[model samples]
Target: MKYISKNIVFSVLVLSFFGISSLNAQNDNSKIEQLIEKKRNYNQTEVKSKGYIIQLYNGNETKAYAVQQKFDEMFPAYTSKMKVDLPDWKVQIINFKTRLAADRALNLFREEFVGANIPKS
Candidate 1:
């Protein structure tokens, strides 16, 4: 009877130790998860990088603006910008994060703007 009680006590202590440790582990995991979420939010809000840009039109200012207006009407989801470089004016959709994303945009734009492409940089 004494030996059985001692074994039961030992088992209970071991189980309690593991249970406490598991609780601590869960707390640690929650802290880690919070930190990761914070970092993700910070990255989204603070970091800004110029990724891929697809040039839709490259010619004179008048034609570039015309293309920009047409593009705005066609792809309202995307934003376009006009840049003046020397004698040429460029109308582009900017801030694509990956080549795959740019390629997808290119495919969509290609249906309307035949000259749409992702320029090599």
Candidate 2:
């Protein structure tokens, strides 16, 4: 019947679409893996190299999160860490591959705090 043929054709088209999408998804994932392999490897020594240190209020995760969000927006490739001490929280951003990159992030973060913040190598 015409109805049966039409239904079969529609089902075949949907199945084909899903099949093609799955192959495309796999290809995209492979490209991402290759790029990750190419990115710089971060180690403890590099982490200690040079960075920017900003002290936030104790238990003030809200501000840290906000600052992190802003920082990530400007320097999506940078790394950061948060340390807690007796009555204060310290946030440091480091492992920058170049001074220019580090300086750029420091300038952007200055939108929140300004002073002797960034530590240069």
lDDT by residue for model 1 over 9-63, one digit each (tens)? 9999999999999999999999999999998898678644568899998899898
- The ten-residue window of minimal lDDT in model 1 covers 42-51
Error of 2 at 113 (Å): 5.2
At residue 12, candidate 2 shows an lDDT of 100
The best candidate by TM-score is 1
What are the lDDT scores of the predictions, listed in order?
A: 0.91, 0.63
The local lDDT score (0 to 100) that residue 52 gets in candidate 2 is 41
- Candidate 2 lDDT, tens digit per residue, 23-75? 99999999998877666454433565543443322246667666666666765
Instruction: Evaluate residue 12 in candidate 1 and report its C-alpha lDDT on the 0 to 100 scale.
Output: 100
Segments in model 2 whose C-alpha atoms lie over 4 Å from true places: 41-113, 116-121
Kindly report which residue pairs in candidate 1 clash with one another.
Answer: none
lDDT of 1 at 74: 85
Top model number, lDDT = 1
